[model samples]
Target: MAIKFLFFPFTHMNKSQLKTVLAFFPACHYLSMNRDFKHDPSLQTLFETGKINPIFPLPEPLEKVEQNFGQYLAWARIHKGNKVNLKSLLKDSPYFTDDSDVTAITSQIKGEKSDKEDANADALTKEQSLLQDLLFLKMAHLCDEQNEGIDLALNDLIIGHDTLIASLRGCQSLVSHVKDKKTIARKDLGEMMPGQRIRAWARSLSAMGALEPQGGTPLFITTSEAVFGYLEASCKDLVNALDIHKIKVHENECENKNEWQHLFCTWLMRAVQGDGIRENDMPVVDDRCSLLGQVKLALFSGNGINKIFNCSDKQIPVCLIKLK
Candidate 1:
């Protein structure tokens, strides 16, 4: 019988030597010993189950793995003919076999160059076509501008009408609040609102000479001619939309001075209604039969004037009457 002796040696080891020994063992051995189990239990379970496999085989040296990746990148660059130092890359890499392999890579690179040149030529042609289209658009814009001056005038008229309507609405709201039985007079309606801001903007138009001030009144008003001209010039669509027979100017009510004053007040009441001016809390203006005295008064008094009107200047109109 041959005697067999098993030589077991336990020696004091440095950190690196201990690490090498640990690296040689299976991961489970380290977990059992409580030596190197930094990974999560779930991850260890997955590793044990092989659900998530490693990209490469283990025992791979980090440097060699990095070098292998560099070789792959070099090969990719050569295959694509991307600008790179091919000679330096081939210096130490063994994967690139021989001169013939390099020659094949160069041939592929030349073909890619030809393809790129063709693509660039096609791009140039498309760019030139786009440039021509842009030039045509520029010329067309010039022609459109020359032909559309009257359109701008009509737009101005519409804008003026909108401004006047907005101002009238503001006045209506202020007056409505004052008339409300629960509302306090000077306290609530004392200051300006956003509507008043719109009204203030009329002053800018007056400064531009687009509007003028009435002689006795502070409200800068636009003339009927100016309003009509703007409407005819810029807002032909609006004018065309209205029935011509329905159009009426109530200026004839001003007989002398006092009658004219009454007529103006009456016209204002009518204009306010026509302008779609309303306060949310206020009662709607009533319509009476033509034979009724109040109805006749309203008609003759110009209570429902509908034609668009504007101030010539930025002047605030004072409210003299509280219409119920």
Candidate 2:
């Protein structure tokens, strides 16, 4: 199987390999539009006026995906100022591909006539998933920069809300934990559970809604699968305590003992009825109503032959909660 072009999490891919992969639609859009961007008088004016600023000659070898992606957004913002245009560029390639060409590419990749229909479906799913990952990474970059970032402000223009900025403030501590380690691990779990980090995130959502009412609950996205796994493991206890089978969505409807299970909501709900008493009369979460709950967990995947999300040493565990 020819898997070279797939680029899973992409930590190992060299510069030439990345350049080869990015020669396609979505990535190519910026590279084509911003050819010699320094020559553009309008963009140069924006730079002079303290409007658009992007790190050019992006960190030689360009190993980190965000370094290049940040540059892409910078070019797009300078050229396309409209929210509609920016969001479209963020989600899809401005240059359109015809159906015949797309079909041919899909057929070549899958290399089987009988699997043509399945291949098309799978390819679309993977493409959409990739776009989603990109979106999350961009947001994570904004969250990391917090007070110093303008990407979230630009995103507010696209999404029509400043909730992400406020929400970032609430989860800044948790974000820092991952940033310090560069991955998720058992210690991260310790910090999350004992500190009631999940509850804090839920409260952040609640505050966002109260401060600026919006259509839906904004998700607290993270690259920490360890955090997700901790919540997933608690699904059984939450199921028993809350007496809601639907709380944990199983892979199958039948009573399969070994079926994979995941939480419907990554937010932690108080399984018990009342707030715990405090020794020193500390503040407690008012749990009269359900807090708006949502979270998206992005994870890294590598072939069994390739080690991922961990160091070569067996004992000294390092953080692996990285953006793909």
Candidate 3:
């Protein structure tokens, strides 16, 4: 007798459909190691009390999820700026805005000039300190909400909610320190602990074509891509969906043709391999190949048009130039 197991790929299914399938695969359920302790108590209570519903709606639409996550990142950036800017503005208003009128007004005040200057300086310092405190509170609140959103997304995915919450909490602490003026060392975004399971879940969602990783540390994004590729290949439908576009190579006609051609060829080869394309099937075009040549020219010509040229729905003019 031989033991056997079945694996069903449900990459294309939306949240509701995925839940239905997971319901039948009870053995596959695994808790995220990074789960938030604060939220975990409530979640466990809900589960124990039979309040865990099988059909809870996802917090946002699939297309909007990545956008929502991007908004969180943007909020993080703005929050950091708000702390620094608010503090600086209070400490030295002239640094942020013109204060010629204030300077003249201060000079006109006659009595107790030295005392007034000291008092003003003290007041400004206090205001800056208060603003810094408020910014930290706002950052903490934003972090909490973001952590909750991550958990909700994980709950939908059926993985990594706990681990994600823990990571978010850690991130919040690090970011809070970064916002404080008294902090001696600058917080390195890249130095944060790598939550491998959360990364995997994010990549899994990306592989399902439900999300896209935007701006982040290069190492994080690279590791995420590796995990995403693995999970994506696990689904036959996703693999098929990805194969619709193929990366090909062609020689470049630049002044440094040899170097450019070599680099382009190597990059194209890697892309093809990464996409699971067979070596023999990789397309090769001539140096004068219209589409490839145009793409190369576009890259050199300007920014913002690199990938747009290759998009399936793109339209380009087919002007004819004749040599005399």
Q: Which predicted model would earn the best TM-score?
A: 2
Error of 2 at 183 (Å): 30
Residues forming the 10-long window of minimal summed lDDT in candidate 3: 315-324
In order of appearance, the predictions have TM-scores of: 0.15, 0.21, 0.18
Q: Determine the C-alpha RMSD for candidate 2 after optimal superposition of all C-alphas.
A: 21.7
lDDT of 3 by residue, 109-210 (tens): 211234545566555553333222222222333443455455456554433444456467777564544433221221211122223223323333333333
Local lDDT at 225 for model 3: 28
Candidate 1 residue 175 C-alpha distance from true site, Å:
54
Q: Write the per-residue lDDT of candidate 1 for residues 1-324, one digit (tens) a residue.
A: 111110001111112222222221111111111122244464455446642222211122223323433444466766566345655565666755531244333432232334544455455553333222222222222333333444445555655565567567877564544433222111111121212222222322233233333322222111112222322333323211111111111121122323323443344443333443222322222332111111111111111111121432221221111111
Least accurate 10 contiguous residues by lDDT in model 2:
24-33
Each candidate's lDDT (Cα)?
0.28, 0.29, 0.30
Candidate 2 similarity to native, TM-score? 0.21
After superposition, which runs of candidate 1 have C-alpha atoms over 4 Å from their true positions?
A: 1-220, 224-227, 236-256, 275-324
Per-residue lDDT value at 240 in model 2: 21
| Predicted structure 2: lDDT | 0.29
Under the 3 Å rule for N, CA and C atoms, how many clashes does model 3 have? 4
